[model samples]
Target chain A: MTMAQMDRLLFGDNQFFGINHMSEEKARAQAMRFQKTDAIMEVLDVAYAEGIRTFMCTTHDRITEVADRVRADPVRYADFRFYPCMPYAHKYANAVTDHGMVGALRHFMPSDGVLSTALTGGRALATKEVDGIAKVLIDMEMKMFHGLQTPVIFVQNVFTDLLLGMGFTRALRIFHDHVVTKYGVEPAFITMNMPMLLEALEKEGIERPIICANINKIGFRMSGGFDAYLDALRSGRVRAVAMSVYASGAIPPDEAIHWISELPGVESIVFGASSAGNIRGTKALVDKYMGAPA
Target chain B: MDHKVRIGVVGLGKMGLSHFAMVNAHPQVETIACDGAGFMVDVLGRNLENTIYRDYDTMLDAERLDAVVIATPSRLHAPMTTAALERGLHVFCEKPFCLDWADSERLATLAADKARVAQVGYHYRYVGAFREMKRILDTGALGRITHVLAEAYGPVVLRPKRSTWRSQKSEGGGCLYDYAAHPVNLLNWFFGTPAQASGSVLTPIFSDGIDDQVTATLGWDEGPTAQLSVNWSDESHRKMTTRITMIGTNGRIFADRQECQVYLRAPDPALPGFEAGWTVKYTTELTEDPWFYLRGEEYSAQLADFSGAVAEGQGKAVENDFASAAQTDRTMAMMIENAETGQPVGAPPVTARPTPARKRGWFAWKA
Candidate 1:
């Protein structure tokens, strides 16, 4: 069996969803700018043309349209892959409760594996609410990327940090096991505190697990401090994927990318930029600093 | 003080649960949970490996807690906080410290007398952009701020909804205490307690006997004037959007949760970050990453500060301390009185109060 190769540079979905950690003005403006799916696809196309094969994104509602377009036109995006992240958990449970299991499965599940997924729901429905909710979220969130290449699934920061804080790290293993067994894909964790998570994952018997976190020169959102991250990366115990490499535009492209390229174990960099010029410029920086993508 | 601060958390509403999660997770803290709601306590107890209590006083008595975090409804803050302080426990209470100004003043003095770490959850002070605003203002980059605009709008009550404690005048103090108090507290942090607050209006769009919108004017003796416009009913925004814009003689400074925009007519060598024209600095640039992040960095940051203050023991002044919150509470009281009497309250003479020696162009807002 062979594992899918992780792309060195991945385009991110934050720009499409108006998630600017820096500027609300820019977030709101870009949100309005990318209201239509075409605008998002156009940027994705630019990223794809510039040699970014992977799209790391949250399972937002609009992603269905993008998936449909990608699935519809396989020739244009021949090597396209998705790294789908989970969104709001409460919203998922609400959907299941409001629409009932079967009704929500209709709205949420893609046609290909609906039968088996819904059948598993019977056993899930018998479990406690918390366990049931997690199942519903994973199943529904993955439903959008039907018949697409999803090499990696991510547990969002909110869930990852909460579990990390609560010391319920056993759940991380459950997530990894479920994603691997069910989807036949690797599960990665996105967290603010990469050092803590690396320890947590290692304790859970997951070795060299891909963990993405805020890694930048200013150390903007890289929790557990820069020294800890440097130690973790230098030791090569975890498969590191650096996100927020630009620190949300705080650091310039050449400066941020060059700094990240020097890190020991970072295997990927994920970024979000709306404009084609930005996408091209950042891709050029990544290639220049870290060599061309595999 | 105990090496690991033993803490008890009371009231497990939304904010309470989150605070409990962070508190229970702290490395330097051993925390127990309490809530009046039996179901909440039971649920938390079943999942989390911690002692849970149904009564606040019972938890305080049973546990040798050095501190307590009060995240109850707004009405219960004053009593809960007072009880915790009386126990010689450091208290970190949720915002709108008290619905009434007198309670705020009383509690402020009580916390001072008791020598306990008293902090209110005005988490905005932890936000990076706002902190940048403070840093610039401290540098005297925006010289002699004259006029200001403070606004907060959110899509909270878009249509008529059933009233909960949140929508009630008595329990939550409606929009004035519950919603507008956020920006108002930020105003207090920027300027000293306003000498006068006037032209206050509290209007309801979707709730009865409570305000969903608030508008008012605040003034300081030094010269800076400010307007407060907040509406929770506005649907244009996705969430609560608080912004402050200051117009000064030297330049203008504007800040929100995400970014700070600074303008200087003639840039000084001392202020390297800002140019002669508009320079924008973002939250990403200003903030350090938290050891743990929940909701946003600010939420975890506030709890971490409270924990650190508790560990440091008495005389460790918190950033958003009870005294600082009392200033905001008093300002709200002035606005409420002005609204009732159709006249300005606490209006100082339209002239100079004897300027303090420290009141140079540097730290002008300190006065």
Candidate 2:
């Protein structure tokens, strides 16, 4: 995905769910404040009002409510498209805790693929079929986002890092193929360690993969380092989605935007905000620094 | 003979050294130090004429100490604290208390059994602004608190390579244990244990398996709610910044290291010093310049309190004791579990509130 294809300022679900990098106190406050779907929609509406129509969000259970609310009001959300990030691992993890592993798979399996999925799930578990299980699980996760306009689906960092650590490079291919062949949209990967992930993706024959990672001036949470990230961006090999450009609230807004704007190949910047003021302010800053996203 | 509390400090890293300096400077306290790093022991031995050893056990055996300050990593906190308590020494372990809740619980039990002063270093509690906030809250100036927001942000672990023991999951690395402990302890200080907790996300911004960012919501049975957001990866904050905002029925209190702002809808006579409306108090007004201030007033105040407790034979009720610290650890564990499982990890849900009736017309309410 390129800058033109993706929204320069994509709204994120972290704020809606009370995810804050700096404060658990603030996160819990946000969670309670945005407990209702309407509260979440209010923030999304603020982002939309500020000309940010694309929402890069996770497939969290609450997001299904958001997708439903958006789908219900087609006129208002006419231009809205969800960059559905997937394998909200907590959802599956919770399901497995409540119900057994196979039971949880069955619970999430699509209606048409119930029997086949069950057989595949049983065999995969028994034989340790990592790729087969990954494919099935991806399909299962994509089930909630069935009718939404998901131009790009991302593998969340949890699973991405897991696969990366396990050296399960083949799983990335399975996700890419399924997202491309089945959904007809490109697949993206969210990771903390982007350099290694990008190299792995290239080795797997996936060229110019879209990878979202922490790309900031201070190298906050950048796995390799600022230099490596800069080198990767300058190399123009992988498409980069820069998140945490504010470095988890460390850098000043203008400086952060200006620094990131000058970087070579950052295709998009995804940020989370809880209020209209923050949404408007961030959008203006990005536009001022990045020059209206070309 | 000098009537002073003789204290031995173990794990002379960043926090240990700070404590050593504070205790050494106090007129009423004498200090000894130990660390696994021989160079650190040598450095402290050279500076202060106190006994310094590379091994904690050797130092404990060699020195006649009334108390021990344990500033080791979270994984080692429990063992060191238990050993000190068993040795009949008042123990002060740094924040996080321990890596696991079970271990913290065991340590708390040991401390209780030994009848020793066991304080966990939640230095924020001693900070002038937060202390003032706590005092105001105690006066019921804000009425019944409806919600609280605690935040701690810093750029300490911005890169993966900067990962220390704090970045390792086994060693209690990440913002959750290292940074979140402050806000978690603050929340528990304001309100007792949360009745229910959910919607947790532990994000590893730079390193896998190391949570650089943590968010969670805690609900109290008495209607108060709390939110915690801590990100060690935030580069915007030059240093770790902690802020707590409490929304109460009658007013609000927003406090950080710099200042405390309290807003009241109506002045309560119960809170004598506070006015009816908004009041902003700066830390400069509340803080006192200590004779030997090295880190901050809060750090000095905490060490002074620990030393005083030892001197007066009143170390048993040092405010931030192991029991309370263990409660914070338990809540944190629940939040982490909730984040991992995507489920509510605390007590069973209370009865749901009734949904409000939908509006029929703009004038419906007036009519």
Candidate 3:
């Protein structure tokens, strides 16, 4: 995925779902505030009005309602497209708990891959076919975004790091191939440990894999440290999407944007905001620093 | 009649040997030992009168063990625990429970089904200073805690060493999982599950792929916000230095290995002998020196708890059970996710407090 194709400022869904890393009180309040789809839409509308057309969001259960609402009012969301991140693992875990494993798999199996996926899932579970299980699961996760424009599909960090730790590089290839072949979208892996993940993906014969990781000053949560990340960016060995630009409320906004703008390979910064003012403020800062078009 | 719990110790590494010594010292326990390293197994065989085997499975097959303590590298934790649990043996495995949350969850389920006294080795919880802190918090003297800060720093892995499993990420290397687990588990123990978290993992100060430092913020839906900062690269300290500070509406409590300090804004009857201002209590003041305080009291305390639970036959909920360890795993996962995604990864809130019933009209206050 190239910088031009992805909007410099991509809106994220954590704020709407009541996720605030710095303060649980605020997170709970926001979650209560946006419990309804309309409340989420109102915030999304504010972001949309402020010129953020790309919504980079997890495949949260509530997000489907937002997607349906957006789809219904095409005129309002005419330019909106999704950057769907997948394997909302908690959803799957809960599904498995409520239903049996096979029943959960059936519940999420796409219409196109129902039979094949079911057979593959069963065989994979029984025989420990890692690639087969991964392929079916990715397809199942993409079912919610069937009619949407998903130019980039992310493997959320939870699953991505798990694969990295297990050294299951083949699963990365499977995700890449299936996303490209079936959805015709670029595959991106989100990981807390970026340098190691980048090397892992490259080892799997994936050249310049799109990786999203924590990149900020203070090296806040950047694994391998900030200098290593800077070296990787300067080397141009991979495509990078910078998240946690604010260091989860640590760095000031202007300094965050200014520091990130000077970085070599970061193509986009994903951020979440609960109010219109914060949304517009962040957008203005990105436009100022990154020269993102209004 | 001999009623001592028959136990096996696996992976005679630093922790394994320590646990073996503790188990041997316990009057209520008899121990067998195993290690992949033949020399370590031989040494253990010579040192202890207990049986010794090079392979863990062979020991399990040959010996009748009531319980087992696994001190293997993190990658082996899940498999070893599962194998022991399958054989109907209670287990006390070392920290980071498993490298992956999926494996941890699976083992948790198995342990639950088998009704085994499974516990993760988070020895810091058994420290006297922290136990006193827990006692204070449990008394509600802290009064609606608002924030908790946990810091652990040391020079454990200060230089580049030969590639061991601890230096490899796939093998659960790094301070993030190993050293940071103490503070993370402590936070979970002190404030329950966080509603959300975000942080960064830093590495390569000493080794590659193994994270040497981690800084994270864990937020609860209502109670307290928590922050953790751990570094295994600090060269000033010879051993790990851990400190936790809890901020509450009425007071703040700070604790470490040696001492605990409490500052209260107002006097509460809940805390006897503690006045409205500041109070300092050392660990020496709190806990009596034990009979076999050789490898630290916390380690002995955890083993004693595990032994008691094993003796009980039914799985009793211990402080650091598989489920609690899994909660730490989930929090670590969220921290990693937040660090990578730059968004605060959300967790389910702690039990939601009931909204107070409001009386209607102007006479509500009077009523």
Candidate 4:
């Protein structure tokens, strides 16, 4: 009922409490910036010192950069976690693809350009397009799910479908695809990509990886964006809810802070920042709301 | 008795009816003839004579009117006014002379060449509160304006919705074009043409590509800047009002229909504890008259001015030819286009939903 209770539920696990770092196309092009490895570790260290245990980046390219930079220094910063940009990779890829069952499979697959090219060009052993994309997705999950341990996916409006619309509990279990008919590997793992389905994994007494959601849905007012999430929380329909409170900047900071704190089952809210100024402002706001020591 | 002049009315929408009422009521003026969408002709036929013609050309040719009041569709406003001007008739066209800047400029140039009195329907200039603010600015009592925030909001009911004339992009019946005309015209009337405008446009409720909400930042000639918010998707049907706040070098003026307040921040003290902060120097509230004031005072004043202009050959009419109205129209058109395409279409880069420093404490806000 109180905000303190909700904050404890969300942040108590010491899961990745993070601030998003946005880099522009120009910034991305200039590979030579501040010592890439040391700079990233420095930011992770900053987040870690602020009671943050996990770190996440936005794009696949950014994630690869961080993953590559931290590859050698993995043990150097063992206390932190890395969240590769998988959600946007799926969404962006979907935006470009033609609509079909194969396209839907590709929507769940990873954003590795090499893997995507291999599937497209028939370089990889693909029985069919859907099977090919599903194989890539399965391989991706197996590859990263173990390394990252718990990966966070940012869903755009799809989270509502999983939670309130059709519960994905049964769908995750029934993975009778034509890919399995041809290949020996079963692709029941597609449910991991669905936010509500992944959340349900925890309730079924299966310890699934944690998924943080940053819902950047358009037409927040019309889609009943917040109302759906609020209804889910109030009805105890959702178990692991991460409140991306500031996704729509229309909601005032004070009101958002209050609502996030009072939501029944909200876990963590990932802070998005365009610049260091934004991070600083958010940090101040968080501190002000939590009654944390200034 | 003074020799009376004749004035013809065109496109009888709500504004057209106001013009008809004014023309009929005034003693010195004669309503020579008028034309609108057939509905207006029906509305006017009860009181006025059968001086109504369906087509503007027929009305112009048949009636020997000395001047004309144009309240036609935005796309036709420029052409209609231009035609009237060429016929040697003094013209008063509605706000947004053209849907775009180029068209507005062409109309402006045409009006300049003619020896006829021309003005756009920027009636807010004659509004009492605006008139008061103008006086305060002229007196230099408020000092130089540093920051200005002008807000205007109303439901879709203010402007009658038409299928062909309004809904069409060519006709210019979108949010920024229809509702925004008031604020844009007022902004131009209050301040000059904004050097550059950056803003976001949206159609949250309405299915049409027409915008329902818009927030814009206008950079002025001087260092002072302005933020304007105009919305048509307000909760209730009737939400008609324009609120303006101007922050000047010496003082700040906040004006709305309910109350108007002027704040003067006293100079801070050199010492810490004794430092003086901003203080409200003057506050005044106009008596709340019934809704009939719109029909009685505002409409009557505008009609009287138009009648006087027609009779005396010279009088202040609604500013249909003001350069600011044209720029405002251009800004609205550009904003609507920008909303349709994510790219900044001849407009400045604008964030769709920028983090507001202060909350829009409408019914949405709990506190």
| Candidate maximizing DockQ | 1
Off by over 4 Å in 3: A1-294, B347-367
Each model's C-alpha lDDT? 0.82, 0.78, 0.77, 0.51
Clashing pairs in 1: none
Question: DockQ for model 3?
Answer: 0.01
Over B1-367, each residue of candidate 3 has an lDDT whose tens digit, in order, gives 2588999888876577667766765667887878885333532344345677889889998998898999998899989998999998899999999878888888888899888898999988888788999999999987888778899998766666656677787888888888888898888888766788866555567686668888988888877777788998896553577889998878999988766889989878898988998997766446543323333557767887888888877585477999889888888888888877887788644645634547565655666
Per-residue alpha-carbon lDDT of candidate 1 for residues A1-294, written as tens digits (9 for 90 to 100): 246568789888988877777778877898898999999999899889888989998888888999999999989988999999886554554454344434554455445554435444543332254444456558778999999999899998888877777666766787887788889898999998889889988988998888989888987777778899999999989778899887766688899999999888998999888888998998888888898544
**lDDT by residue for model 3 over A1-294, one digit each (tens)?**
333377888889888776654443466588789889988889888888888998989888788888888878878788988988887766675454344445655666555654446444443232233345567787766777767778999988867765564344566787898888877778898876677778778888888878888788767556545677888888888778888898776689999989999988888889988878889999999998998532
Give the docking tier of candidate 3. Answer: incorrect
Error at B193, model 4, angstroms: 1.1
- TM-scores for all candidates: the values are 0.87, 0.54, 0.53, 0.47
**Models, CA RMSD each:** 5.7, 17.5, 19.5, 21.4
lDDT of 1 by residue, B244-360 (tens): 999987799999998899999988666776779999887767776676776788998998888898898754446888889989888888888898898989866264554465636
Interface RMSD per candidate: 5.0, 20.4, 18.5, 26.4
Q: What is the DockQ of each candidate?
A: 0.36, 0.01, 0.01, 0.01
Model 1 earns a TM-score of 0.87
Query: Could you give the CAPRI-style class of model 2?
Result: incorrect
Q: What is the lDDT of residue A187 in candidate 2?
A: 92
Error of 1 at A281 (Å): 2.8
Angstrom error at residue B73, model 1? 1.3
Show where candidate 4 strays beyond 4 Å.
A1-294, B36-47, B157-164, B266-296, B315-320, B334-367
Tell me the lDDT of model 3 at B186: 89
